[model samples]
Target chain A: MSQPAIETHDLTKRYGKARGITDINLTVNRGEIFGFIGPNGAGKSTTIRTLLGLISKTSGSATVLGYDITNERKEMLAHVGYLPSEVFYYDGMRAKDLLKYAASFYDGDFTQRIQDLAARLDLDLSKRIDDMSLGNKKKVGIIQGLLHSPDLIILDEPTSGLDPLAQRTFFDLIREENERGATVLFSSHILSEVQNICDRVAIIRDGRIIETQSIAELRRTAVKRVSVTAAGEVPLNLATLGLPAGSFAGAETEGPQTSFVFNGDCNVLLSALAARRLADVNITEPSLEEIFMHYYQDGADRGGAAHDSAAQDGAQR
Target chain B: MNVYLFEFRRQWRSFLAGTLTQAIVAAVFLGGMYPMYHDSQKDVEKVLAGFPPRFAAAFGITKDMFSFGGFFAFIYVYLAIVAAIFGALWGLKVFGREKLDRCMDFLISKPASRMGLFWQKALVVLTGIVVMNGVFLGVALWVRTSVGATSPGVGQFVLMALAVGGVQLIFAALGALIAVLAPRLHSVTGLGVGLGILGFVLSALPPMTNESNFKAISPFSYFNVSQMQTQGTYETGYLVTAGALCVVALAVACVAYVRSDVKA
Candidate 1:
């Protein structure tokens, strides 16, 4: 097999009394759109920074495109395209000047590549960087970061500022790059986009990698979003049924309706609720958003992990 | 190489402004005051002699005060201070402007190493200093010719200019060092200007107090103006220390910058 695009072994970065990443072991294989999903302050940026050599890791090691990040940054960055969450270029420069300046750092002439990307992203190359709105500047950054046609593209919230239509074009561009054999490690807050395009994904929370699995496997988990409406005297013990913390969605004891994400046996839940005078019931597969919430809010317990192995087998059918 | 060229393209306006400011200071000072002082040389000396020694010392004039060289020496200290301040701010901004712009990741993520980037930025500062001094020297020479008195030899005049440039270099190098040491700086003006004025105070203190030892504290005193006036050259020890300080500070800055984090 070809070498993975990125590999980190127990990579850790500890800020002084701040929550930096800890023991982050990740492997993004070549030619895959790998998603890095985490909430704000969840160490996603820290991990990406450590890999990019923007900050020194407190311990452990990481390699990008087979070159050690710490020791071989120059050699490795030659082939790596990075789009930071914020796009702030030098002041008083035009979009084309910024792109040309970025191109000057590489080996080949990227004039045609830059023109192609600016057209594709619908960016005005002659506009001054200071005059462009946030979205336009982000488009400039996208073109600047991608014109080199790198072997691996690392984007941190690359679609944050773009409008819906621009985001569509941006995603299409990324897909084209991926099809050209560029591995992509995309970190973003939008789970639906991750669900729509990512082949495999990793979920990070509280500075740790909570879970890593394929998008299909993650969506295929046995956890069900179940809601029920029952008459008086209806009952259920949520604590004993292994419903995740904050997963009950206000499944109040006195309310007429109760809803929760259930990861336990469906038959057991059904048999227990059979005695109730139920008026309405709904059980459906949870979206990736719901599962991502479970992984983030459920802590280190078996909230999501309990169904991980089961989900892989469930996908077979 | 591209980084260096880009820095020049980005900062040529600022550098031109700095150079113009120095030229204007020289023009106004020499153009407005030099001829009046030249005609009333004896009268001015008598007035200066009648003044309290402490007040005279405050102006950093020790022995000679009549000739064009002495006149040139009179303005060198203040010019050097201004140059030093400009260099300090230039160094800080050149090295850390990306941080202030919140765009460190944009350049630091390139294929170049951090040290390579540091040297390129440092070269920009050095180039600016050369251009600033070059323009200042030309302006001072033009002012001297207009005064129609050329007592100070060409070499001595050049030494005085070099001394000011050297002082500016020290401050610029030190400023670059401070920038690399800081993770990020919001406004470098406070630190740059504060330290610059402090250096001026320290250099002035020794001459004001009649203590040669105070000269050890500031690079401004490193190029003894009297030595440049008399011998047409710099003192070997202080000059070597000044040069060494730049080398060491720049070396340390490169090492620190290569390891320091670029904060957003």
Candidate 2:
């Protein structure tokens, strides 16, 4: 129980010049709901697939429940329950039959468990899978994944086809399982979904983990989205401002306005903008996307130069 | 074993369909026409002689066409192609069904090893072929005895019927190989049908193509019904080829499936 739920050291996968996860180092402690947040094509699925042995890794190592993924795959899988993003099953099979087939792999009888799950999810076990709606099929997938009560539960975009009510029920189920001593790795592109449930999150962008922190710490990150509309020509790039290298994120210039996600001393930015004949300046809290850009730039700037600025404003997102 | 039973449950209907097709074809074509053709051999020969030599040869006609052995061989030639088609698609369907259904990730993440999955699923294909051709052999024998096919002994007729099993086995292994190796293989049925017809065309073309090892690659060419009628066993050369092909195909499929990634 003291062992981490998952541990990966410099885990990397390369798809022959295509974008795959690179130098991913991560650890999920036992009995924790660890969020894996990223935008689309950010390698969340690839990382999960690699850990599950759906895809092979080019280099590095990973283990789940203290079992080596590649060598002890079968033993490792025995303790893992996975729900793929898209739910699909043999269409001709009744939902009950598919769940029974899934349960046969585990040691204990899941008959009562399946019934309880089916009742909780409002799923009809007797319906043929083809005749079921997409949401119903998803419920079947959920039951199949959870019937064994595996030690580790890995969900990749688990709520896409579910209704809002079902989503709420699903989240409640996950939290219930977490309380019952199960560890979860919840992968999603939706930030709020992760923020609401996860104790800690690892943010991935362009196949690299850019930031990993507690939910509160992530919210408290000193990143701001600043858009400036000046009467004069907008600065061609953020580099011409002569601000500290690590203090600001990359900028986007649209016509007479230049917008950038900024981090660190707000007064430095205000004083820089004060020198220009400013028509308007809007400094608002950054979106999760904007915060990602801030971290993305921080990764680049930290690689080339020393960065020590840690000033944060009192703005709430 | 659980996987095999689950697959058998899902696939028995399709297997029965294949068996039923062969039974109907055998009952209608052989049971209906054998006595008439037997009574008026010369008249039918005269009509068949009017056909061009290549066309007659392509359909496996020879001087012994009046005999029960030759008559059965003529019908069997086309039936073998049907069995091959069934074998190929059944093989592909066993592996490709999950991918086509988008349930590969869920099924693959189960605790079973890929090799375990491969063997169990492959057992289903072998079982289907045996069931299909087993019923087929029984029908053929029943028709032959009812029509009183006199020349080819029971041993020879049984050997000839069992040759369909050989053809099915080779094509089934080939189909599984394609499924395990090719991730994006669309239209598995189309490819199966195309390859089945190609085998028949290749076997029928030696008289025109000057017999340049073209038949070597075709499962249809791997057995001679006339030879089976006379010798009571498959040819040693083609028998070796079929065994080698089936072994190599199934072995490669097992290894590749076990090692390769299950693409989503």
Candidate 3:
């Protein structure tokens, strides 16, 4: 197996009494688009900043492209392209000027690379940076990050202010970059985008990773919604058909129709439904948002210790 | 080398603006002193009827007020003020603008050391000061030759300008240090100007009060242009002290800059 493109061991960042990110252990594989899903103030940016060496980590070890992040910051930074959440640019500078200024730092034919990327992204190089809109500014940032063809591309909320078309174009560019052997670690609160692009995702909540898995695995383990139409009173003991007892959370009855929400394996629920004598039944797969909500809510209720234990188990795997 | 050239290109326009402003102000100040030079000789005779010519000579005015060196000295204080202000402005802007524009990351990401950046910026400011003084000296020489006067050799005039440039450099380095240490202030340029004025006042006060001890505290007093006028030369100790203060200020700035976190 190839070495992990990026790995962090028990990363913790504390700002005085407040916690930044606590014990975040993550591993991202090469050429994979890994999504870091979290809500606002969930330390997603903090983790990305730490990885880029934009901010110091309180205690942890992280390696990118086989270089230690702390000891070999400049060397590691050369191989990593970072897009900060908040973008700032020099005043009165044209986009082309800014790109050239940034390009001067790196070796190789960066000018041609920048020109090609700008053309592909449809960015107007002659426009002044301050005059550009937020979406255009984001495009400028994207071009700068990817122009060098870095080994690891770390983006914090890469599609926050983009229109749907722009977002799709960005994802396509990211896919192309990945195909070129670059690994991507993108953070987002929108689950749909993460679901669409990411090969694996780590769901973070309240400064900790609650779950990390492939989309397919999450879908298979996520709870299913079941709607059953019964001719008469439905039996409460549905587990007799082989579904887990706790799977049948509750049932809603409207005259002859009774619908149940199951919080367990969808396949088992379907088997139980097939064995039942129901007049009508419908099953719907949970959306990524629903799955994320379930895991986040569950983790919040259980608190940090349980989440850490589950994360440890995932890490060990 | 690319980083240095890039910074130079990026800062050229602003530096040009500052240099032009310095030239205009210096022209107005030196031009205004032209009439005062001719009037001072007549006034000296009337104001000191009983004083000996030796006493008048002690003050270093030989009644040839139109001479290039004398006229240059007549406006040297104002010229120094302009040079100091220009240096301070450049210093503050060079260090502080990066923080304000959030471009420190862009610069630091390059293969340039922090101390190297500080020195490069200081060099740029010093170069501009030299160029500005060169223009003033050129103008003074033109005026002297047009009126058919033979003045001091070019080397002597340049040495005197270098002395003033040394003093300007000390204040510029100090301004850069302040900008690096306190980047959040909105009025860093104003602070630099105020500090330059304060240095001038502190340097002037000790001499005006005839206290040699207090003179050591101000870098300006150490570069005593008036004493240089009487002796036709500057003290080696003053030049050493000015050079030492500039080095210390730049050292402090470099240490602080390399260690301080770049606040975006």
Best by DockQ: 1
Q: Using lDDT, give the best candidate's number.
A: 1
**Ranking by lDDT, best first?**
1, 2, 3
- The candidates' DockQ values read 0.78, 0.56, 0.31
**Candidate 1 runs further than 4 Å off:** A227-258, A265-283, A300-317, B27-35, B139-152, B183-193
- For every model in order, the TM-score on chain A comes to 0.87, 0.79, 0.87
Q: Compared with the true structure, what per-residue lDDT tens digits does model 1 show for residues A149-266? A: 9999999988988999999999999999999999999998889999888999988876777778899887777667887776655545566544435444424454667777766566
Question: Fraction of reference contacts reproduced per prediction?
Answer: 0.91, 0.72, 0.28
lDDT per residue (tens digit) for residues A1-317 in model 3? 88799898888877789988888889999999999998999889888777766567889899888878777777777777877666778888899998887776678768888888778777899999999998888888888888788888988888877778888788898999899999999898888988999898898876777788887777766566567776457643454667764455445667657555567666777776677677777777667787777666656655667667867766665
lDDT of 3 at A22: 81
Residue B145 lDDT, candidate 2, scale 0-100: 89
Ranking by TM-score: 1, 2, 3
lDDT of each candidate versus the true structure: 0.83, 0.83, 0.72
lDDT for each residue of candidate 1 in B156-243, tens digit (9 for 90 to 100): 7877878888988999999898887876687788888887898888887886788988777878889887678877777898989998
- For candidate 1, the TM-score of chain A alone versus the native chain A is 0.87
Give model 3's TM-score for chain A to 2 decimal places. Answer: 0.87
